[model samples]
Target: MEQSFLAYLRGRTRSLPSVAVGIGDDAAVLDFPINGQPTAVANEPGSGVLQQVACTDQIIDGVDFCSESQPLASIGYKSIAINLSDIAAMGATPTAALVTLALPAHNATEIAGEVYEGILEACGQFGVAIAGGDLSTYDGPLSINVTLLGTVTDPWLRSGAKEGDAIFVTGSLGGSLAGRHLRPIPRIELATRLRQIATVNAAIDISDGFSLDLDRMLAASRVGAELDIENIPISEAAQEMSQTSGRTPLEHAWSDGEDFELIFTVGESDAIKLEQLSADELTTAITRVGTVVGRTGLWKRVPGSKLQRVFPQGYVHGETDE
Candidate 1:
């Protein structure tokens, strides 16, 4: 097996497809639209509407998730779904996706099409189109990266959260190990509806669990939060599956990572309207489990400590000292 393969192909050749002008230059001219933008976009007035936000997530053969033993189709669908969920988190509607893949020689034929079908099916159900993407070979573990573009009248972000805001999360958390991880619902429409009724300060998709993601939100807004662990939504599915753990199934919803729900904060100004809209628009319950407070700093309401204890356990970014 090839240990590492990352290089650039630099040259123009007769072998190039007519659709591709030159990839080795400042930019690769393609026969297709990038991010679903039309060649005529420059002519559009008022800067073409932001059709969507583009994001990418990867699942490598030995990292991010499981090894190749996982079902090829599920692996494929999930690769695309993970990125789409980001669009959904911000209340954005995905209109298209681009899928790029790399794999060991033996893994290509076995997984590529199955993955594309996953991408295509997700696009169909979610009302997105497949514009185009690049396919290639590598000498390493399989890696699938999907770049998704979505459109929302207003795209939500983590910087909007503010002090005195109400923090709410949709749907139950935890028990993903029971299978929610393999297939989780994208809260796209719910987010769109939320945008209409709720004046959001900030928003983030819960890919890395609530605590870590929320930490980012709070940090961005320069605020601290107080969470009522009892009020946190725990999935009935998670409770049924837990064997032994003191952190409570709620912790998984709180910090397990990859639940893919949206963790957004709204000010009290819109609380009542949100309640009314949520009733008509959501299948899952949206609960305001806490509030943003003065910069007493980032903390969780863990028992035994003061009512507001610091949460230092959110996901941290680091591997080890080289």
Candidate 2:
């Protein structure tokens, strides 16, 4: 339904000339003019002007969190952190955010204050300023929305992936719902350091399940992937969740959403350079999980078993896996 609705919107909506990227990748990049001069062309290297990157996300009570049990501040932090993750995925520097709140009529003032405390905490940690937004008391559950703005000279796009590229993911995957989902550590510094060290062909954040988000990148790049089951990093939380969930830790790593890690592709030489880096140097553990293939489907290689096609399973808002 999300894809079909997005397709419908794409069919009807016409993008303006200034829109560098619209409704496709992590964020919408716009080629805003700088001092009467147009910014460098989209996807081109060595652009003097910074392209504007914008993204917005919302989290609601009950759906994103249990308002009764969880701290309101954490919920607010998550609202901004998710958008920051989007900005980090674009390899951009987040500058500011506009926060909007939909508060319940009961204890609205106290709830708003607590949520703002979380929002402010995240913004302070990330060096983002709250620009402006709207607030309203409604008859519904608490909801928080954040619109993040950033700038980038050379944006890493999903379509940039090519055949023979080595796929890598920062940090472990799966079982973020154990409590880490609310306090996401956006890889802004890591992404910047990565660009400085090597050429990143394509990049994306694992907001949904790893398989689903990786599939989205592959679809954009018009390529396929062959993953090694053993190489995929399964988190400790995933292991714990697997015990009673009747699924393997790997299955949780593959399809569990809200990991917020980064999955990227690089060339063979660059991949070697990245792999050689110690954990202390990168400040994050990155694993080489797969290789980009020429075909157009996701495949996994299991030990002793033949290569098998795998469905991209993950969180699909308002829809179930078919």
Candidate 3:
């Protein structure tokens, strides 16, 4: 339903010439020309032009979190962290953020201050400044919206993957609802280091499930993927969640949402280089989970079984399949 609504919105919208990427990806990339010159020159240094990447996200009480149970500070931190994850996916340097809040009518002032404390904490950690935003009171659940802005020389887009490219993911996955969801560590520094090392063909943050987000990237790239089940990193949180969830840790790792880790594709040579990088160089571990294929859907291979089709499954707003 989210996809369907996005499709509808896409059909009705018309992109401007400055818009390099308008919709259907992690963020929108827009070209900002300097000194009345086109910034389309390839490999030109000191061109005084940059692509501005922008993305916005909203979190509401009762849906994203329960205000009564969860700490407001965590909620505020998460609002900024999630947007930073989007910027990380684009391999961009985050600059500033505009945050809007809809506070509850009762105790609105105190709640707003607590939320801002969390927001400011995250912003300071990331070197981002609070640009500007609006605030208001509402009878409905509290809602916080953040619009993040970043700059990139050449944005890593989702449509650049090629057949035979290797699929890589940073950090472990799954069981985000086990308290990891509120404090996401955005891969901004790691993504910057990766840009310095290898050429990322396509990239996306696993905000939804791994399978679902990978499927989105594959669809954008017009390619398919074949994942090695054994290679996928299942987190300890996933293992803990599996005990009573009646599901395998691998299953949770594959389908859980809000992992906030990056899933990117690279050529074979780059993949080899990345795999050879030492822990000190990477700071964070990256796993080669799969490979891009010429087909048009997702497939997975177990150790002893043939490749089998895997449907994209994850959290979708306004819908429930759990």
lDDT of 1 by residue, 76-170 (tens): 77787777777776556777778888867885776687777766777777787888888888788778878777654444556557778888888
Cα-based lDDT at residue 230, candidate 3: 84
TM-scores vs. true structure, each candidate: 0.77, 0.95, 0.94
Tens-digit lDDT string for candidate 3 (60-82): 99988898889999999999999
Cα RMSD (Å) per model? Answer: 8.5, 1.9, 2.6
lDDT of 2 by residue, 74-157 (tens): 998899999988888888899999999999999999999999999999999999999999999999999998999999877888
The stretch of ten residues in a row with the least summed lDDT in candidate 2 is 40-49
Native-referenced Cα lDDT, model 1: 0.66
Global lDDT for candidate 3?
Answer: 0.90
Question: What stretches of model 3 exceed 4 Å from their correct place?
Answer: 15-18, 36-49, 302-305
- Count: clashes, candidate 2: 0
Candidate 2: Cα lDDT at 254: 95
**True-vs-predicted CA distance for residue 23, candidate 1, Å:** 25
lDDT order of candidates, top first? 3, 2, 1
Candidate 2 segments whose C-alpha is farther than 4 A from its true place: 15-18, 36-49, 302-306
